[model samples]
Target chain A: MQDPFVRIEGVSKLFGAFQAVRDVNLTVGKGEIFALLGGSGCGKTTLLRMLAGFEEPSAGRIFLDGQDMTGVPPWERPVHMMFQSYALFPHMSVEKNVAYGLKHERMTKAEREERVRAMLDLVQLTQFAHRKPHQISGGQRQRVALARALARQPKLLLLDEPLAALDKKLREQTQFELMSIQERTGVTFIVVTHDQEEAMTLADRIAVMDKGQVRQSGTPTDIYEYPNSRFVAGFIGSITSFDGRVTAVEGEVSRVDVPGLGTEIVARSVAGAASGQAVTVALRPEKVTLTRDRLEGPNAIAGEIKDIAYFGKDSLYRVTLPSGQLIAVHGVNAKRAEAGRPDWHDKVWLSFDPAAAILLTE
Target chain B: MRRRPIFLISVLCFGFAFFYIPILSMIVYSFNGSRLATVWGGFSTKWYVSLFSNRQVGAALLLSLKIALISATMATILGTMAGIALARFRRFKGRLFFSGMVTAPLIMPDVITGISSLMLFILMAEWIGWPATRGFTTITLAHITFSMVYVTTIVQSRLISAERDIEEAAMDLGSKPWQVLWDITLPVIFPAILSGWLLAFTISLDEVVITSFTTGPGNTTLPLLIWSKVKLGVTPDINALATIIVLVVGIGVVIAGWLMNRAEKQRDRDARLAYRANE
Candidate 1:
């Protein structure tokens, strides 16, 4: 097997007495877009900074293409970083900004110009060569920053919240554009972002971080479908959780009896738990089906509709189970609904597939 | 609500006259034809010509210009470095002590600084057998000691407002630390350094107390010459010299203002270009 493009081996960073990153180990395949997704102060940005050589790890080592980069400075490393603020030199023209790193590469003037022109064209900023950074709009500045970082043809590109400064509509469009650019260039990209949707849309794999450690690392589908912990399930998306005890285990499925909902739910469990062990069952709102009549399924609970949030394409129903547990059911807002809609205060049955209910042990 | 127009105009006129009357009188007396310093005979440029022709005044003006230029240039360089270091680097063991030492000259009386520097130079001369006498070198050194305090203060404030992330980003893009300093840090602080030089120059040129104590017989500066002339009773030639000095200072002020305006416009243009590029 070929080695990963970049490998982080037990990397840790400490600021004086406080540990900012703790025993983080991960690997990035060549040409893959990996995301470090977390909230503020979760060490995602710190990890990105360490990869860019701005911060040295207090413990462990990092390797890029099988070469150790433990004590190398940022300027000596073959990695480039796009700062969150898009730190473009305000005094230089766009062409000068993009060609800044090439000046030190011992290339001829013509070669430098050709490379700079190619990068500008790549980022779609060729016409603004003579203009300074301030003459451009926010999105244009972001592109210029990206072009500047890529001009050196770095082995790895680090983006610190690349689309964070843009508005909602622009952020969505730019996220797709960034993904396409990464795909086209075949450069290994490590994007650090706090936006879950941004991570889901752009990253081939994500390392969801909390506090200073990776809570979970997997594909977006795996993270969404089978979160290893309650924090991951709650942080990734909205989830309905129930306190329960395991009653039986059979192959890939486990039966959990939840007292509040007054039902036995068969859920997929990766973590082995003996019978009578306390656990939590997580179900996504969109996975639950709501109907007026009682339904027979692996997981079914009778409840009364408490409230309805009418979205354009989907409506969310908040149901109060007979055991006084609140659960949410998302219903499609189409002409032909999947199941009959239950009005507010009406008694209903909520049912979910056994495979959809994930048993979380953490 | 608007007040009475005449009342506002009257107040403005009063304020203008209160400031300009003495300066206008100095200019008027510069052209007086009479030898009696206070009484004017008629308008003539004889005193202006004599002011230029006088050997003592000429030498003093030259000495003052040389000292001011040299001292101000040195002060600006040292102060700018101090400012950049203080603003950009994190605090260390003696950071507070160093910052306090840089600013101490600003509040210390000129007489005290002049006397102390003179005494120190004398002691050094006794110990090392150098600086044979108090002269232009000592005066220039004295001027820089005080003027650098002001320059460092101004430059430090300007550097504090500049973003350090710009320099870090330059380094992140594979530029060395020196390159980042030259390209990003220097350009951002250039305006502050220029203005600080101008301020130091003007202060050194107009200094009197320190110059008086540190200067020898042949090293009298313009202010020192003017002080001596005042003791012998001021003449129309002195008025002519004063007017010329004021005119030169006015031109300097205008030039400084123009340079500051140009720098601000360039900064704005750069910011606009960045904004457009981001779009």
Candidate 2:
């Protein structure tokens, strides 16, 4: 957000007795695909609606391109949204639907038609321009919606669960198409989605939210590897957390005694974090390496594999420790379904380096 | 015939008989050549010829059409506005009272509404000196008042089920409020408005009690003429007139039914096509 194109300062929204969004401060850099990631009713959509001028913030101001967006109606704002339902006009053909927003602009009819043709071409939907929305496939309808929103060429674009309506394969293809379109248009995008994988794959940066508050905001890898809170780690990815207390603090590493695991854990510590303070030690599923033999590592625990789920390229093993706490370990199938892979009821050793375990004090 | 129960067949026969018997009897009697409505001397076209030649009946029919058309149009416009207000603005002062009063006409007795309107017209004439005599203008005003209630209720329910996000989408795409209504909302609800207008037109054309209470001497609508003719005696010409009215109404209902069915079929086909296109 060094050269911010859109800034939301201390924005909060309240619906009667329920506070939909807490005090939120965020800035999106120009031409960046920023995502607001959360569960249902976590205020991600409300924040997006506020940015599109559909909903007014109850207590704070929003600035777009250094101009205050206070009291500006949605029709006047230089922002547009691709709705979750698409909301394509049922009475209009695809060509007309894409040209709808241009009716208000001061342009000649020929120029408007040219712009619409270009937008349809950009989304690779020029062949289906004259078809009605329902006459096309779900994937084609989605492209029509994208084409319509981009036809306006607004300064900022908001997308609400753009791929939620499509099948899995179509959604994956649409994600890449959306990214390339954003790259070509150079329009700032703020997407709101409850699907964490979609956010990870499509976002340049993501803000993970919980209960009306932002827990963490960073690049996909940064948030995945170093989540700052227990909620962030659990929400963004699958993690097994244990209650522990800091026993000793080294310069950059700390040893914590966890009663749940019947062992002590070594994790990278926060600067100036004192010993004897209670904290939660979190380990991601894929971060823990599972093997048949015990490793000479700082963090290794023995567990019995209670369940095995094969997902073609990889497998998920639910391991039950001696203390009855189950830990999930994602094992990559390096060898093609060989006997060396761990199976149910097999005893295994799960090990991770000290840098892999995230230490959360809150 | 394929394993159909005898009891189900009897019920179906009973239902159709109950709906169609009265209309069938009326159409049959219209062909009666005798002056007595109950006695059929022979089939003849004399009654139809006399009915078409009557100047009084022709004038009344024309006046009725004019009143129905004007009232139905005015009612639809006002009703659409009221419906949108009630459906969109959730929190307004006196909303409960406003909605309750709007629907009161639907359930109120025609005698009560007619009499009450009569009194109001008299009072207005005394005070404002407008509507100097009650006739076409007074009758149309009264029809619009009651007919708009039906329009409002129909429009309100149709609008409630309409996708609200479409309007917000229009606004987000830089449409003004009026532009959004014209370009998006109204088109989505056009069929509802059309049905409402037709209902209003039918109610106005069929109403007699209200017209009687409000009409002056010269303005004789078709229903008023028929009522006066029936008082003298049920004439063969009146039977011919009634048969024509029933045929027109039956045709209208058939067309409307076909239109609604076709629209529903189109929607189903579109849904199927969308899925097929996916593969």
Candidate 3:
């Protein structure tokens, strides 16, 4: 973040009476893969389009590498986009598509061909260079779109829902492939995606947008662990939150009286929360431990195991407290078959460390 | 195949007989050796030979072909520009009115279009003093004015189904608006434009009322000549000319159909390739 390569300054877009993006400001560093992650109709795509010069902000300004992008046409800007549909020209071959942007550059024919070959090789599509887009699979088409967008060597690249079309396996594989490509090319990428996991895996930093405003902007870990609002916490991952009031505040800890848990829980004290203030205590499933051993803490409670969703490497155990509220706890299935594992309807003790709970007062 | 109902079969036969009987009779009478009208004679190729060498037929045919070709090409260009403007430029002053005017000629009666264009040409001649003689140029202008409507409709409908992302992608890749149009938009809609040209060409070739209104002395198109000849009296040579016209047009249609089929086959192959790509 030393040098801000792409800076969006108080950008806002309005479609007649509807405001699509509202007072959004962000800065992306060079060679960093930044993500604008949000759900549908959240203005994530709108912000990305504004950066690519497709839609000029109705208010505010955008700067790319110290150059003002206002009033510049998409073709004149030093940024390219990979559309969600990939948008490969059906009439053109893969090589031709990758080489499309190069035709206007002041390069020799040989240089253009060499650059195209290098790009095709980078996307691992050299063998299908002569094939049309429909002649290739969807995964290959996605790579072709990537290769085409990167061929121009612009100051930045915009990718909108880059891997939404692929199956789960291909999406996961392409997520890493995209990161590797970004590393190799050193081109700043602004990826817009609805998939939170995609943003977490592919981006160095993410801006989570909702309802035309940015909720939080930070690294993946920072946003997941230290979400500023309940919306961000719920949107980013699965977590059980309790409506509570802070009963007491001690050094670095707060005792919250949660009616949902019907217990006083000790959690990490969040800034700006005082005694008698309303706060929401959020606990992630993986942070809570399901054990039979006696745990001595206000954060511990005895509950009956209601359900268990078993994965190969891990299992999610849902325990219902006497207050009739269920809390999810994840346990790693390390041993092949454990002897003393609690079954359905078995009483179990659920404990979470005071530091693991996220206290929000928004 | 299951046996079709007698009523359906009879209706189909009656419909086809109603259409093809005139053409069949015309073809059959073209080889008549007798000079008297409606008199049957021995088979002979004299009318066909004479029709080929007739100077008036040649002149009219050449003029019709020239006007049709020029008008079709002009209509395709102008109509495609209008179509792209309507499709790409979503909002502009008088866009609705402009689009309405562009498509109005499509449903306008041919007589109205002909008379209006004729009056407009007269006014232009008196005011601007250009096109002093209304012959090939006047006929061509009138044909283009009407045929461009069909072209615009075709191009616009094709573009409705076209993916906007391709053109946006081209522009994002540094292609200017005009360049994007030329490299991406036009190619994507080339088939539509081509079909439009063919439609315009065929329309112009056979348009009788419009041609009759706009044409000047000594500038007879084939349709006008045929109309005049049939008015005078049906001749074996006229029948021969009709047969030749049908043969040429039928061959062109067959070729077009074959080409479209081949394109469809290519798409089928692409589908097979897509299936294979899974493995």
Candidate 4:
């Protein structure tokens, strides 16, 4: 019922002959952590820049808190951006960098210092207030950049690849820290990242982008469980797909007949495909179960394990069905699995519940 | 390897002697008791005292310092502005032409600059009737016209080497263009400006051919005085004055080298720190 914190309608950006962003429309609710996830040159950063007013939309309007911000410059808008390079002024101390925007508001010296102190404390960089950017570590610099962006108490914060500069372990740790900070501030945080795992861990809702367009927008769970398009299904997570034809539609489920496997599989289709329509059935590797003996399930296929990869926590088995379609099955490292391990060239049956498989229309 | 080092050391020593022997001999002759430069009767300080007491030499020295200071300062200011404009604003038309014009003075012969500047000033005076005579003002104007090219080339290279991200970051933090220039641009280029100013000052101070053509009776610089004194035959007083000039130049060179070395060390330290932080 409440107005969305930020609303984008028909936004498009062009750079010479290349169309960077094509008619992107989305809305972020107040206190929501939204992510724009895509690969390189997918226009995720361009969309975020347009939202922050650094880049203007060639065709569309943006509304922030019921006010239009299409023509507003970055300095005038009630928004702040954390650059991909974390463009901290190298000459200034941490305190001066954080207090920079406050000084523009003509705030008193006391008021500016107070806000700066509070922001540094919020980011836990109060002790490094006098340190220059080069004196701090990358993680500390990241916190300093965050403190500087939040010092103005912006209604919206745009982060461009917030953790891309960090190492793998540090990046993973910082993702949670960033989420906690977003929760504490309760500001609308819109993060742009090419890392899907980071988006899954940080965003409440995600818009998967490809070729300057939003392929699908949904919660992480919804996107992972039910992807509307093939791009979204392949991009968000690993998926094993098979081309099939819809046989019948009953209630909310559709029965699909797939070749090579010689099985009738039922899958849930949100797009409402008609009978006899060609469709693709996508299943996550972890959702399918692999066993030496035949297993009872709604959808089942018999195949031979072609390759086995032993991960510490689990084992991944690549199975080739009689129809020559390769499918992957992930088995957890449980007590029973330790006693009996499936080897390569072993006859295996892969089975999953019908609800676990999704029917992708595109 | 040791033999090679010895050979290189001997070559370097020979080079140093070849450059300094003539200047050192002149300085030794400055303290000579005899008026003839080749014959030294005994070491004495009479020539030094007499050189200071000479009215023409004192007046010429003062004129040279005044012209150097004024011309160098004006050239540095104009060149710095031009450098920042060219380096920061890349969209302007004829940018290449502007840059070429700035460097044209550096390669142009001193004779050409002197002749052209004299003609320009003369024509302007005849048309505008502002500068009534060819004196200190005219000489200073001429020195600045050529010295500005050197300053612009140095400052422009420094500006190009500086990171644009710093300026953009300042702007993103709500500072206007002028504020960015004042707080960020100026500070980053301060060392370059100082070095350029020193270079201009040195060039203007030592200039002979251009100053000789432009100077009038009342605007004779120190080099012009030395020239006229030499034409009258070598005098111990002139030698003493030349020795003093050489000492002043040596000290200036040492100080400038020290300042530049310190700046380079600071830049290296900052770069190392930035690299570590990124890691």
iRMS of each prediction: 3.2, 1.1, 1.0, 3.4
Candidate 4 lDDT, tens digit per residue, B1-279? 699999999999999999999899889889999978778789999998988788988888899999999999999999898888888885788988988888888889889988887787789889999577888999998988888888888888998988875676566667778888988888778889988998999999989999887877677899998998899898988889989988988998899789889977987787587667556
Residue by residue across A254-291, what tens digits does model 1's lDDT show?
Answer: 88998856778888766666678999999999999888
Cα TM-score of candidate 1: 0.93
> What's the TM for model 2?
0.97
- Residue B1's lDDT within candidate 3 is 41
lDDT of 1: 0.89
Best by lDDT: 3
C-alpha local distance difference test of each model: 0.89, 0.91, 0.92, 0.87
Chain B TM per candidate, please? 0.91, 0.95, 0.95, 0.92
Residue by residue across B3-96, what tens digits does model 1's lDDT show? 7898899999999999999999999989999988889899999998888789999898899899999999999988888888888778788999
Off-target runs (Cα >4 Å) in candidate 3 are B1-15, B34-39
> Residue pairs in steric clash, candidate 4?
none
Runs of candidate 2 exceeding 4 Å displacement = A336-339, B1-4
lDDT of 4 by residue, A198-310 (tens): 99999999999999999999899989988888899999889999898999988778899998777888887556687999999999999988888888767778899999898
Q: Least accurate stretch of 10 residues (summed lDDT) in model 3 chain B?
A: B1-10
DockQ: which candidate is best?
2
